[model samples]
Target: MSIILFIILLLFLIGQQVFFEVFQILCYTDFRLIRNEESEMAFDGIVVANLAYELKEKLINGRISKIAQPETDELLLTVKSASGQYRLLISADASLPLLYLTDTNKPSPMTAPNFCMLLRKHISGGRIVDIYQPGLERIIHFKIEHLDELGDLCRKELIIEIMGKHSNIIFCSEDGKIIDSIKHVSAQMSSVREVLPGRDYFVPDTMSKADPLTVSFEEFSSHLTRKPMPVSKAIYTSFTGISPVTAEEICSLAEMDSSIAAKEYSEDLLLHLYTQFSIYLSAVKEHTFTPVIYFNGSEPKEFAALPLSHFSNYMPKEFSSISQVLETYYATRNQLTRIRQKSADLRHVVQTALERNRKKYDLQLRQLKDTESRDKYKVYGELINTYGYNVAPGEKKLEALNYYTNEIVSIPLDPVRTPQENAQRYFAKYNKQKRTFEALTVLCKETAEEISYLESVQTALDIALTENDLAEIKEELTNSGYIRRRYTKKKVKIKNKPLHYISSDGFHIYVGKNNLQNDQLTFHFAVGNDWWFHAKQAPGSHVIVRTNGAELPDTTFEEAARLAAYYSSMRGSDKVEIDYVEKKQVKKPGGGKPGFVVYYTNYSMVIDSNISQIRLCAD
Candidate 1:
């Protein structure tokens, strides 16, 4: 049992890992699709600048045709190309790097959101003049030439922030005076330029590095060891506009493990690493590399010229670029999301039921052990009562008794009790254990059956696809009175059925699943002249016979007993007593629970589930 439980827990943990991996992949894909990067690393300002240079030669006076907020921190600008015919969507979202042509609209607040209003006011009819980046920093500036209120041509700068966690849009005047920003930072918040009206705004100072796209082989190797770090860490931390993701990619191309220390490499190996790095930079500069690569898994282990890990089996052997990784990641994540959405509640219920059953079994185990010891006292008493006077006190210990034969030749007394007293004590113990055994027979059977029923319910819930299926189950619960219906003025009518069965005598019967159904079955649906049944002192279904004026046969009585057993927690047990009486004798309890009722002059019989012997009515 413990092993089984441990395996269950392990499976759950693995499931969680899979879910998270899928979620990460979806996030990456969404980001890439919205941002529109040719390659994974193209999300930053440097890559954008390279592309901007190409687009600028063709687009000098394109007008902004559309503006949208695809995400909270992202913007999409549809601009007419310089050719005056083609429309291009340039997206700038730091989280994603791929540009996509998506036809979706964002919902606006009753009052326009700050970013919406800012974009609407400044760039609604602005004409694009040029796009530029400040060096290779992760920032893009769009120069827009527009007509002012006086119809005079003016240039306004729109800064697209691409830095992680600080991505935003800032609209500035030609004089560099901050007009307003999508996100504002006061001087108190940061000593860097305050992005509010009247304050001068400038880009944050970024660290510089020899562009990996243009670094010499000697320069790359020397700069790498200047810091005592892992080669992966050194390249990522020292590079500007280069993400850790890109640095890891670089190491993969070099075929050197990122886990290894930079200083551990021999001179020959260092030369080889530098050569690989140089070749990767040249590939990017020449646009010779593919834009996308797919991994068996979502993450790309390789980048520009680096391997992200010493271990690589989980990595795909052939991803040409990072964009493909994003696509595959999202696809897998979407699948997981759908699966999780379908099974979330049922999974929780199964886990909860398993925990409940484990605890119940443990309790039963302890009780069984206790009962075993108590039963010995009963055996001892019975033996002594029959023949204690003829033997010595020590002679009739437990070892001397033959209980199976029901004979004791000579039984002795306990030193603490006289022979008569000892015999009576043992006899009393024996009788008590017999009674307890009878009661436990029922209790254990009921508990086990309940566990079984709950497990079946869980199974049913797991595969349920439509709301109607859930509604049907919920209807059963409501009829059983597990949940109460609210009284409304609209006079809602319930369209549920009573549980139907046919006795061996061919008499039809009905049972109620809940308190509401109980009342409806016993008082409204039941013929007062028929028989009714219920489990004494327990929660169970209300059972009724539809005999009209016919007398119920013994077989019918027992058939009803089986149903009483099945509906109660005692279902499937060896036996159960079902209290049956004329339906007329049944009366609703005053101020009692919905299904709670009282009955008089009832008969009872023990019966097993064997419901197959009883006929069931169709819907």
Candidate 2:
């Protein structure tokens, strides 16, 4: 079975013995989409405790200067303190709830969300009094002190729950009465909890798990064997803050197989597991977190508050803060999700147009081949006219000699037609074939151009890293008639520019993200003395190198060629041929496609599409 299905089935069976809320770490459908594998990255109780310490140290006495809800379940809070201004991002999204200090900010709606407005009214400039975590549960309580409507001092709780789907940001009174939450869960939505205004606020303890820090060894072994499940599942299910990965780590430290049944473990094995669990508990108590991200190859595999010994196979990168670990680990994932969603529609549009144009191109080529014998029909007509005087009244054949090639030719004739009629028939056939060949030639070129243009758009989408890049690509497709334009009074201003890189030799290299940028880079931005590089006979970006009135270096040329190849459809090829020429030699066609250009004399080289050594200008 597939890993996703296996996880689903495993969790489903465990759900009978475990509460759905505690084990929600495994069952979110969107979590499967977040990573190709079962991601060991988690936001469990240990992480919450580490975050609690960081938040208390960083945010105590800080004033909430601004609040915005960029997404319905997300909050961006800018806090000002003696330390410095910091932005705290919190998400109550079910599938992937998160909390971190980030350098990036998202755009908010013109009209704020209702929960955002409520928080602004209650604690817009409130000072954070305390940041606490209740045991090891995935919840953070931010106690903010502010002046009420009557100018009286008051304290309120801004609790963020990192429970999947059940995750929420709750605004509550000092006495634990719920004011409002980012998400409402009534009896119909969830019988276990009701998170509505006027309702009492409390974290549900449906799992009734033992505290790993306080529980005795006998108690741990007794609670674990109660459920006949894997040792890893039993450990996580028996403890409040433990995730499956943490449980596996504990088992690995004990030199035990996590997949073995908890009921099968002997007393000695249980004691070994208990000792390892105590070590983790002691680490959490002493705050000895390494705060590192584990990378499998170049992709982030897992992140943790403590050192993960089993993940030693993966390269570990330590961070100064847990928030930095979270931010760094999710950075690539965030970009991928954002770009994927933005480019999905464009991919469909480009692919549909490509399929249609390719079909038309094939049909056009077939029809053009049928007209290949147009000259032969013309020869037949001439030969018949020259030899028609010898024809009988009902002749079925016409033989002629002394043709252009000096060879005898036989022409089939209509038996009941006269010589004049036969000549007219052959001449009509020749004229029709000649016209078809001429029309199909132009049609085939147009169809081929359309296919190439669409393919270039696809390549652009493939290499696009930012929403601005996708915006340019989408605009190109919309203007090219593959997508319909939505008539709006105000056009969204695009700040997209070509990707700028500096060669190892210190030359400036610019790569166009799409066809429009290609046009802008070539005809408008580049000077006549600059160098242009592109993948030969393939759909790709136009790479321009600025000479600045100096002699060109070979390294810059090769670096620019690498960029051209990396951003092309032929990027997977081991060696792609790149055509480079001086900007003066490249000419834009009168009304060709956006990226279409004609150049006669150009230099060609075969190079691999490895741009890792290339550096981009930070600006």
Candidate 3:
């Protein structure tokens, strides 16, 4: 009996393993239901549906623990689930409407905004019963159950509609009576719909689009063929949920051109397009989603909750959760946008100074070019001194043998002065021009140096990721006299630090974001034996690799050079020359500008500015 039982147990284990393998295969299988080259980053209806599906799995039955409005058009909700805690961020900003889950916290105002206070009062301890997407539309509805002020059970619906400038977050009773909204839109503001308090809430039939989920093949074909527009446009315009991108995907999957007029397509091709569209809808119905982000080079180009086959030529990064994709994509995009906006002032300052310096340099160059003739004046003086006695009193010009070039040359003369006086006058003019040329040469070098320094500052601004990073750059500009220092009772403490990365060979690499940080890293943080790198003859960050008493691997050296090239002004170049040397070999000239280092001997390498393989280490 014991042996029989052991055999049965072994069989059960085998069956369990096979079942798990099948489940994994089902989860990861790619369904190429859609394909399109024209991509978008905007969260459309299909994306929202995927998000709603994922959120329902993780957030349903979760309790609302906290509510905060970090921005005027954004809300952050902390929800506690049986598995763990999650933060849901929603934004209805006119420029960017977004919803995602994140672990990062944003600072809120001291006093909560009126909308935030209202949400907190109603849903502080509410239990989320259902999270759903209403009709294949860009809208999410959250059903919450909570105890009212009288300690009675109550229900409310929080609806978020993501319709570009018409986006809003509305609170309503379970019976659909509007209570309030984050943004109040009156009849005067929008003739289609009024989002004001106490108004009956409803989705406006502005597009008059048919429901994609319930549409039959006959209806789909008739609706699309009736429009004399591009096939892609007809699909999106006729359906409530389909975006131009999705429509294009359907056309591509059907092996049809999306740009062709809908009526121009044959009946067979139209049937094929409808078939492909239905396959995608079927995947949505089955809750089979694969969140993928397509990249054009290193930057994210587009993202979707379904497999994007048209991006086959480009790199496609897959994610397990739609929320993860949304969070990463938007966070990166937002960081870039914020950096550009915040760095605008600094960029203008640097550009202005660079333009002025460039103009001055050009003028000095022209002046110096004019002084090139000063040598001829000196030669003229010597020639006149040698032949002054032969010159006639009233001669307007003197002809002399051109000894310098072995050619005869004519020298203009001032007949008003004596021959001896003419020679003295030419010598005086020669001396004045020589002095001007020398002084202008020094000024030109100074102006060029200023331009290079400002360019480095601009590169630093581009590399800055946080306000603290900007503060450090701003302080550097002030110290360098490009910006005037404002008088304050207390000085702002500097908290920004250099970026740290770990090479594949377990070596620590440091990249300086700004000039001040570069100086500090090279002079103080780096050791004598550490490897220092910079882009040769370009404005860039100083990259230092710590040796730590070990022989440096060739790969580490190459990675350091790549980092130096990537963080430089020549970032977009196909290849850049990098100079590397021992930290002790790099020296700062006396009274030189920040980040100005002179190295007589260094190793040089030409490399592409790709450091995606290197891992960044948080300091």
Which candidate leads the pack in lDDT? 2
Of 1 and 3, which scores higher on lDDT?
3
lDDT for residue 355 in candidate 2, whole number 0-100 = 90
Q: Model 3: residues >4 Å from true position, as ranges?
A: 1-41, 58-89, 100-129, 144-156, 172-180, 196-283, 288-349, 483-496, 523-532, 546-558, 575-587, 599-608
**Alpha carbon lDDT at 478, candidate 1:** 53
Best by TM-score: 3
Residues 1-619 of candidate 1: C-alpha lDDT, one tens digit per residue = 9978975776587787765665565576466556443233435433454444544654568788766665555566666765653333333445443332233344534665677677777777888877776655667677998877787888889877766434567888899988877666665444655677778877766555756665666777777878788888888776566666656666787788977777788878878777765665564455444333323222232332223333343333434433333334444444544554665654565557667876886687566556665666666666666546665554434335566675543444567667778768877766776677667766776566555545444433432334443454455445434447667789544466666777767899887654456678888988888888876554567788888798888888887877777677565567676788888998886654455577767777766754644556656
Q: What is the alpha-carbon lDDT for the whole of candidate 2?
A: 0.87
Candidate order by TM-score, decreasing, is 3, 2, 1
Residue pair clashes in candidate 2: 94-165
> What is the per-residue lDDT of model 3 for residues 338-381, given as tens digits with 9 covering 90 to 100?
87789899889888999998899899999999999998999898
Error of 2 at 523 (Å): 5.3
Residue-wise lDDT of candidate 2 within 1-619, one digit each (tens)? 6977976886787775564654453444446445423333559899888999998889999999999999988999999988998999998876678898887989999999999999999999999999998888889999999999999999999999987657789999999999999988767556788999999988788999988878999899899888889999999998998998899899989989998898898998898889989988798888777798876423467888988888765567789999998888888667766788878988988888889889989999999999988888888888778889999989898878846999887788999999878988989999999999989999999899899888889999987888998888888888888778999999999998888888988999999989999999999999999999999999999999999999888898888998888789887577999999999999998889999999999999999886756776766
Which candidate do you rate higher for TM-score, 1 or 2? 2
| Each model's lDDT | 0.62, 0.87, 0.86
TM-score: which is higher, 2 or 3?
3
Clashes of each: 23, 1, 0
**TM-score of each model, in listed order:** 0.52, 0.61, 0.73
